[model samples]
Target: MRELLVLLLLLPGPAVAEEAPPAERRTELLYLLRQDCGSCHGMTLAGGLGPALLPEALSDRTVEGLAEVIRAGIPGTPMPPWGFEITGEEARWLARKLKEGIPP
Candidate 1:
């Protein structure tokens, strides 16, 4: 899985974002992350069908890059892009939070 991330990082992509979601929206977004992203990334984010999203695992990855991946997804992989459901800004926020190992 780590190897996949390394390969993904080698690919080129776009990036950007705005302010994080508000309290209510934040809760919804967090639920989306847990239920949607968590489906593949694992509820604990340790690893599963998708790569581990834990902070230590994602240490080498930048927030922008991960955000791009979420927005556009890695080509030729099971990881589908979430552009339809999540905005670039939300994706960026998600990436940043994932980097910090997610809130408890």
Candidate 2:
């Protein structure tokens, strides 16, 4: 019963959907991912000033948690909130991609 409740909570509701950001912005976002984010995360996302963003490194992180970090930024760290530049939906999208490995 407890496990069923947890599973249900994790399931996406029919009325709640998280769509990807506009296609037009993908180019820009990808650039940010490489240049801005890469500045710390590493050009190859192999960990430099910041921790790695590779799928293997992010295997334990939750999409929602990553989205929160993207939106709110980490305190006492170099990471800053990009919420103004990127929407919540877009942040979520990025989190998913980071977990799956961003394509070149």
Candidate 3:
């Protein structure tokens, strides 16, 4: 029983919310957003081949849903999975930023 208890204690706990990426990484991520994502979403994210990422445009979407889309991408669409390039937490942060409306 004690061994089992110790094993349980040693097991990894459920994921906690991750801290925002470091400022340097944040800068890189934003650059990627503007240069890479922007190529498809529009330089201003005002909707081009991809839909607008403005707060109002994403008002109906949940952060988790947006994160999933960012990581997984939409099948049959031009969007490609970015999971290989960015971490899930980073994606979530980007999703939140998009929902809040990133500055121009």
For lDDT, the strongest prediction is 3
TM-scores, one per candidate: 0.77, 0.79, 0.81
CA shift at 3, candidate 1, in angstroms? Answer: 36
- Winning model by TM-score: 3
Q: Give the alpha carbon lDDT tens digit for every residue of 1-104 in model 2.
A: 33433453354543245576654575567678888999999998889999999999999999889999988999999988889898888888888878977644
Each candidate: RMSD to true structure? 11.0, 11.0, 13.2
By summed lDDT, the worst window of 10 consecutive residues in model 3 runs over 8-17
Candidate 1 local lDDT, 56-97, one digit each (tens): 999999988999999898899989999988888788778877
Between which residue pairs do clashes occur in model 3?
A: none
Q: Rank the candidates by TM-score, best first.
A: 3, 2, 1
| C-alpha RMSD of candidate 1 | 11.0
Model 3 earns a TM-score of: 0.81
Lowest-lDDT window of 10 residues in candidate 2?
Answer: 1-10
Higher-scoring candidate on TM-score, 1 or 2: 2
lDDT scores of the candidates, listed in order: 0.76, 0.78, 0.80
